[model samples]
Target: MNENVVVSADWLAERLDEVTVVDVRESWEYDGIGHVPGAVNVPFDSFRDEEGESESAERSGSDPRDAGTLPGAETWADLMGEAGVSADDTVVAYDDTHGVFAARFLVTAEAYGHTDLHLLDGDYSSWMREHETSGDAPDPDPTTYEVRDPEHSPFVGREEVEAAIDDPDSVLVDTRDDWEFEEGHLPGAVNLDWRELVDDETRGLKPRDELESILDAHDITPDKRVVLYCNTARRISHTYVVLSSLGYENVAFYEGSLTDWESVGGPIETES
Candidate 1:
């Protein structure tokens, strides 16, 4: 968890100098309005196609390629290299919805051995809330990340998940929306909407009080051995960072989520 995630808005604000903050929102958001100062716009969808192009169609459910079994390491490395991310640099990524896309960005970075990655606790909404009085948005420096080794991402295999299922202390968290959770989910998994992590109006993650309430409601304590998975694991990884921000320990993400679950012959159940 320590290697893959970073938490605390104050912690990120303090290191604004050393870290490269990225806005991984949709290209439309970047093209229409603007983005954070000194931050680059790298959408999570950027890694879908082979040449690092984004599919901007905005489909529901997670992308299948995000599963560990889909794309090859070389493909992902090329995608990161096209983005200009450095292995040595500390990266901070965020998006409109909690940090799902941001987590995708981080996972890809980590796969390439960019260990110093951080997800902005609440992301764009949090930034706006802190700078509400500020008027003009700062210009973003046009930059791209360079990928090194794409094969190094943290993706749990289906076998790992099956092993954990009966392990008693292990917890699987589903990061999809509430409706998605109600429809069907991995048996024994808990549902905590990723939105709960941030403030509603500003869209930034909630302060400690709100974050605490969310954990309390989900029965997620700091010491629990937790693993998060969503339709394809992108958003759940983002949720992992949020949980890390709240000081939850022993949290990890399943690389291939529901898609892989069914593929591996894992059972599922509707919420009763």
Candidate 2:
């Protein structure tokens, strides 16, 4: 994983006062279960469009599948502002459910031009095993977070995915289980379960060399444009984070994923 993007629990513990810690798990978990000291709660689901459709869908009057597209820039800015996140903060996000939710937050933040983003290496459980936790929630001073043009689009629509089906330079990855991939997958897509990238014991990312070997074995090298997806885009968000942390420059995800693809009668392949 990219050392710059992933930080160990010990690393975070040392600089806890210098960075903005965000607990992206549900409020119940953040409150009842306890979280890192001084961390602010910004539930993961808050990142998605509440109406279950993106602003683009609203304009076209398209009743697309509810694959949980992201909210508009203004909405994201407001959410960040409310969470006491400023544009200049070096944010460190962590969640209990692996790093999927935290990864989603980081990716969305990157899309909104937040450059100093990082993910805790492991889940909250792993942290709890080694560090102290607290139930107190911090009421941070709110800061104005203005939205700006994205430095890079971290998502791709169906049209770009369709074009990639035949693009020699692009590789489509299905970040689902073997059973799910065998049941049905996008044509020309390869399977790479997101769980494989994380250590089963530590619940943190596998070592860099191991991750590199796995990706190399799958031909998911850093040279190609990698597009990722899962049933609803939730699971694949983890893989998107992994690829980005691995220094894969041209990585993006299909926000609508297979649900939206099937809604539009897109082709699918199943193991015979």
Candidate 3:
């Protein structure tokens, strides 16, 4: 994994005042359970659209698939602005859910052209074990976050995913549970649960060699373009961060994922 994308607790502790720490947990958890000092709360749900209320639906008529879709770029800018995060600020995001939600936040930030993004190596539980916490919320001074053209597109649409089904140089990875994959998955997609990439105890990514070995066993190599997806792109976000941090240059995620796939009658293969 790239050292830059995953920061150790010690590293964060040293630079706590220099970086913007975001807790992607819910508001209740942020207040009830305490968080890293000076951390801001930006729930993972902020990146998504409400069911039947997406901006896409407003423009192109309502489609069930539009629900939970990623909102437009301006919305993302507003989210960052409301959270007092500027585009140039170095962001370190964390959550209790094994960094899955935190990874989602990082991916969204990258999509909107934020360059310096990192995931706290372990979950809040691990951090609490080693670092101090605070129940007092910081009153962040909001800033104007201007959205610019993204340097790289980390999200792929349904059409691109459809074409990838037949592209030998591309691979579609279903980062969901075994039972979920067994029930049904995209044609030619391989199952590699997102949990497999995380250390069960630390709730952080596994050791470098172990991660490489796991990916190698699944034939997910750096040379090939990788497209990851889960039910609604939440679970796959974790794998996307892992692949990108591992120096996979051609990695992108299906933002709509299986929810949109099934909505449009996209082909699915069941493990029999």
lDDT (CA) for every model shown?
A: 0.64, 0.82, 0.82
**TM-score winner between candidates 2 and 3:** 3
What is the model-wide C-alpha lDDT for candidate 2? 0.82
Q: What is the lDDT of residue 149 in candidate 2?
A: 59
RMSD of candidates 1 onward, in order? 5.8, 3.0, 3.1
Better of 1 and 3 by lDDT: 3
lDDT of 3: 0.82
- lDDT tens digits, residue span 54-141, model 2: 3332332332222346666778888989989998889999998779889888877776778888889987987799999999999988
Clashing pairs in 3: none
Candidate 2 to truth, TM: 0.91
TM-score of each: 0.74, 0.91, 0.91
lDDT for position 121 in model 2 = 90
Off by over 4 Å in 3: 1-3, 52-68
Per-residue alpha-carbon lDDT of candidate 3 for residues 138-157, written as tens digits (9 for 90 to 100): 98898999776566676667
Q: Rank the candidates by lDDT, best first.
A: 3, 2, 1
